[model samples]
Target: MTTPELGLPMAVPAQGLPAAVRIYEVGARDGLQNEKGTVPTEVKAEFIHRLADAGLTTIEATSFVHPKWVPQLADAEQLFPRVSELPVALPVLVPNERGLDRALALGARQVAVFASATESFAKANLNRTLDESLAMFEPVVNRAKTEGRHVRGYISMSFGDPWEGAVPIPQVVRVCRALLDMGCDELSLGDTIGVATAGHVRALLSALNEAGVPTHTLGVHFHDTYGQALANTLAALQHGITTVDASAGGLGGCPYAKSATGNLATEDLVWMLRGLGIDTGVDLDRLITTSVWMAEQLGRPSPSRTVRALSHKE
Candidate 1:
């Protein structure tokens, strides 16, 4: 695969690895939102800039939820305009039609709406039942599509919910189907609490496949709370799931689930992908550098093992 040490769309072989995998960088929005203190709008835009400069083609920028809901990302309006000129897709999380309205006004080209397979998480995060949350997102997804924008759906707690020990495969599939039926271009199934193992990963994908959802239309968002994010990611890759959601420097967790830790670190995922001869088009050293700089802003060391090992080697 030929990739500039810094640019994207690297050529990759179709042999054991995926021809190419899209690393959906969710650090700026997801990572920052979970932080204790709010980041300055300038810092957030610069963070997104550095990430895109490192060759992340798609970065989840900011959420359009109310400031009361996510105070860390309260400057969505200010942050979006600053990073609008970047050459990457910036997909923001829109909780409902009102949030979508906010995103539209800012010229958002892509948006994502989230649902939960477990009623416990649904109630906790969306303050609605599982069915009600999906119904709520129906119009939001439809409206985004009508506006010629790319719409993605998310099903949180697909593997396990904090209150619900294990999520049923049927329940997960039902939500996935509903999102796809609602005109979502793709559905990202999240292991929100990160209790997923390789076996569980296979089981969920198998169930989704049997339910007639093609693998191409699916993405996997795995958290590393239990230290199984990479293993679950390998399992998902083996199942032909090419899109993986990760946070830069392992920087995010679900605010509603205090037990949840950071998402799989982008540095870690790229390290594994490169070793497998899979193309991710990310500059590993640059990603580590960016994470290190971001860690400075957060006043802590990064949680990524790859970053830790590589930093010492340097």
Candidate 2:
């Protein structure tokens, strides 16, 4: 095939694209956690089941946070146990030891912890400074490993922040190293506000590589706030990153950062991967259908370009 025009997206080089990619589906957890309306326990369970049926291998289940903090995911206790039987990794987000304890009691086999790259975001998001937040997660990560569960570390605001703009690569790497050293099996760098460009993505990955962080143990989490998630993802893929985090129907935003918006849609990522010839194990058509059904449940159409395109013909 030839390019319609040698442009930015089509201009993407194939030299570094991975043979396959692993998508970390965050619809059930990250996507809906910030929603204003309460999603029924049954609906959340059904959503995870449908995502698995659509061939998502790793679906973030829910968070074990205090209901007073996040009412939308307050049903984590009831939600996780029901979807625990799904034949995939149902990792829940654990904020501290208490959250971890709750997750362990619910038979969680895998878990994730989040940290921030900037001090301002850390204080706003975790109410702790950078070191304090990492210190808090150390025990959680260590204990989760002791419980024989896998742990994923997330570094939010890796690329940029609403309060502090243009985050330095070294600042992001320090937290990244701490997370990995704390026994996190994998670390995902999140572009929380979606201010990253392709150049920024490549530069950050390069810095991580130079800092001795294995690319194989890293993932990329990009938001579509500026419509740059896929482009950043392509840059990451070319840099040898295989794990990509996405949400079904592009259904997520940072509750803390009002400027931040929904996540990169699963269908859009699948569509790009299909064109790149990288296998994601996701059925795009089925994923689109799932997202469309979910949008109906939310009383709105999906924000995913591919989902909207496929679900409704012009």
| Candidate 2 runs further than 4 Å off | 1-13
Best by TM-score: 2
lDDT of 2 by residue, 241-282 (tens): 999999999999988988889999989898888777677898
lDDT of 1 by residue, 1-314 (tens): 55634323344544545768999999998888988877889889889999999999999999999999899988999999999989999999999999999999999999999889899998998889989988999999899999999999988989998898998889899999888988999999899989999999999999989988999999999999889999999889989999999999999998999889999999989977876778788888889889999998888999898888877632
Question: Where is model 1 poorest over a 10-residue stretch in terms of lDDT?
Answer: 4-13
Which lDDT values do the candidates have, in the order given?
0.90, 0.90
